[model samples]
Structure formats: structure tokens, C-alpha cells
Target: MTLDLVNYEQKAHEAVKSFWSNREVAKQKQLLTGKADHGERAGVTAGKNMDGFLALVLDIIQANGLAHAEIHQNRSMLTLPGYFRPTKLWDLLVIYKGELIAAIELKSQVGSFGNNFNNRTEEAIGTAYDLWTAYREEAFGKQPRPFVGWLMMVEDAPKSRCAVRDASPHFPVFGEFEGASYLMRYDLLCQKLVKEQLYTTAALITSTRCAAETGEFSEMSSMTGFRPFVTALAGHVAAAAARLD
Candidate 1:
């Protein structure tokens, strides 16, 4: 059978809840048990949970005719007088639909969604800023047209305090507010997506790893980003990520 998100969620929830429900287990353990580990995956990083999302991105790249999910590429060809390092980088680069597009760093959410927004905002800008090197080079030499793109994965959350969607709608809308107006000109491809409207397809998944017979809490569903046309869009994203060298 396919992976059941509900079951995984419940398991994580119960693991977290057990901190309070089973005080004995909390008190008994020494090195591994503490308030620090009170919640389910309380210490897991955002990148840790984004593997699946990244996989989807990889699939999007390939389906649309791009290349592999290469990482940590060095592009610092020139050195500045007194500025940031010469070597620059983009997370994943591939020629999408025949154009060399760079799928920059991915930003994810963890802890309080609002706080997560701050972190991701910085990450998004940093991801884009790497292009400054090429821009400077262009000023001196033949301009190299590099198509950059950003893929964000908003992880699921429940706690109101940690829930980013609850903190501000703009948290999830970072791409619109920040990426849309970064450079002299916006990406025509992305603009086309927005004007034409784009989307991705995903199965509605929920996890339920609660107490076996204790009967506890659960539920979440969103179709806002899903549309019939999304299948085509997702395929494009996938193919784009796959075609690059």
C-alpha cells in the first residue's frame, strides 16, 4: 500500500504527547529524555522534512526535460575588490524546456511559522543575490542570460503558535511579495505562470499516530493550489528541472 500520511502524523503526535501522558518514560530516560525532546521531532530541521518536496522538484525537472538534481555548484569566476567571496552558487541548475534555468535554494518552514518566514525570506534573497556576480560580470563582458527560479515547500503544521499559515497569509505568499520584484525585470516564464495561473498536484495526506486506543486529535485539507490544469503545470516544472546538464 502507499504511504499513509495520517498514520505518520498520528505517530508523531502521540510521540510528542507521550511526554506529558507518560511522565514515567520522561523521568526514566536520561540522555535522550528531556523537555528539549518533549514534542514529536521537536529538533528536526526544516531541510530534514523537505526531502519529499525536493523529490517532487526533481521529478518536475525531469518530466519537463531538464537534468539531474545536482548540488553545491561553484560559479565564482571573478573576484571583487572588497566584497563577498568570489565563488557563487545556485542549489539546483538545469536547462528547462531548452532554456538554462537555475532552480535556486529551497526555503522551508519550521518552529513558529512567522519566525520561519523571516528565515526563509533571507534565504530567498540570498538565493537570488548569488546572481549579482554574473550581473557584475555582465557589466564588464558579454551578458550571460541566466534564468533563475525559486521553489518553496511549505511544510504542514498544527500548533497555532507554530502554524505559519495562521500567523500571516503573507508567510506562504513570500514568492509573490519578494521574488516578483527583485531584479530589473521579472522572469517572463514565472510571470507567464502567474498571469496564466499555475499550480501543482498533490494527494491530500494526513497522519494519525495517536494512542492506539486513547482516541485523540486530527485533520487538514487544502485544495486552494490545486486545479485541473495543475497536472500540466507540474509536468512542466518537472520536465524543466530534468533537461539541464
Candidate 2:
């Protein structure tokens, strides 16, 4: 069946918009009262806040006739055994008839680029490595390899857009990363994740707090764009549906 991507895009926009709105509300609430709420005390953890977007993905999965598949999103059920680590909780999972179908991780960054860029990159690479190694060791039990995906959303701010200096104490950094912005860094990260075969696909999206309400978001390229992400996911669900019987 043909996919209604336009509608899906609108839903995604709304979902992201709501995410930012909730963050702002939480921030403001913290200001009024000295007590720190969830987002205020710690930081923005959009992972749990992204259920709306994940729901859209679930819509695609269900539409493709994989509604019978086991979908795990709860914190407890999302945990999957890892090769290196004891267990890792994924953002979403699709299991069917004892076979691993798909696993996805969703992340977002609003600010603190300088402090968090390295951490985010390390987590992305490490997580993919752990998951793949576990699969290689048959952690999921003689099942078909699962489709892994990563989707990252970053706030469109001056700091993130400004070119960052790469000071390599020893060897010179690569030409592509000599003088790149945080946004560029994220784009490169996603591109490399797919290029290195760590993830089946990855997407990078950016949007401002004000623009989010208007459903405004930008993508670096078609490869890291949301359309490609949803399309690839939909195609995978369709293929998996065929095997359900």
C-alpha cells in the first residue's frame, strides 16, 4: 500500500512541537517554584517525551499489517540483553513470532552542545556496537537480523550552528571535520552510522522553539532526512508483514 507521507510528516511536526512546548512549560514551572521538576532538576530527556513521534512510527508499523507483532515501549519491556553491557533499554522494539524485527533509538538535544556532543556521539556509537555484537552472538536466539534505526533532533540555535574548532593535540583532524558546527557534527555522525553499517538508517532534524509550533523543521540532506527515515521504516514493516504468515 502507498504511504501517506504528507500526513505522517504533519504528525511528526506536531509531535516535535508538543515536545518543545512541554519542555518550556516544565522550565517555567521550575522558575516559579524553587523545587526542581523532572526536566528542570536534571535536564531535557526527550526520550520519554517522544512517545508522540514513536506513536507515528507505530502507526506505520500497524498499517503495514504488522499489528500482530509484539511492540515493546515500556521502560521494563524495552530492555534487551547486550553483549558488552548487561542490558540496554531501547526506545522501541518490534518482535514477531520469536524473531527480532526492528529496534530504534530516539534522541534529542536542546542546548549544552559543548558539554554533551562528545557524550552523545560516544553513546550512539557504543550503543550500536553493543547491540550488533549481541546479535552476532545470537542474543536474540536464531532469529532474522533486526532493522536498527537512530533518529536525533537538535534545537536550531546560534551555538549549534556556529562553527566549532577542532583542536587535535597530536594528529590533525580529518578534512571533513576540521571546522564543523555541532549541527554538521550530528549530520556526519548519522551519515557515518549508516555508512559503517552500524544502523540500517539514521536521521538528523533541527528546529527552533518558535518554529516548532508552526511545524517547521529542517534536514541536512535527503540521507539524514525524516522522509527517508519513515520510508525505510515503512518498507521494512511491509517486508516483515509478508513473513508474518
Tens-digit lDDT track of model 1 for 1-245? 12112233334334334422333333344225444443433434212343433444444444444434332234442221212445444454543333434333433333354445545455545434545444455522442344444533233334422312223555464443432321101122233333432212222222223332342432222331212122443444444444433
Q: Rate the local accuracy (lDDT) of all candidates.
A: 0.36, 0.84
Q: Write the per-residue lDDT of candidate 2 for residues 112-221, one digit (tens) a residue.
A: 88888899899999999999999999999987668899989888899999999977899999898877999999999999999999999999989887864686889988
Query: For residue 111, what is the lDDT in candidate 2?
Result: 78
List the lowest-lDDT window of 10 residues for candidate 1: 181-190
By TM-score, the best candidate is 2
Off by over 4 Å in 2: 1-6, 37-47
Residue 191 alpha-carbon offset, candidate 1, angstroms:
10
Error of 1 at 130 (Å): 3.4
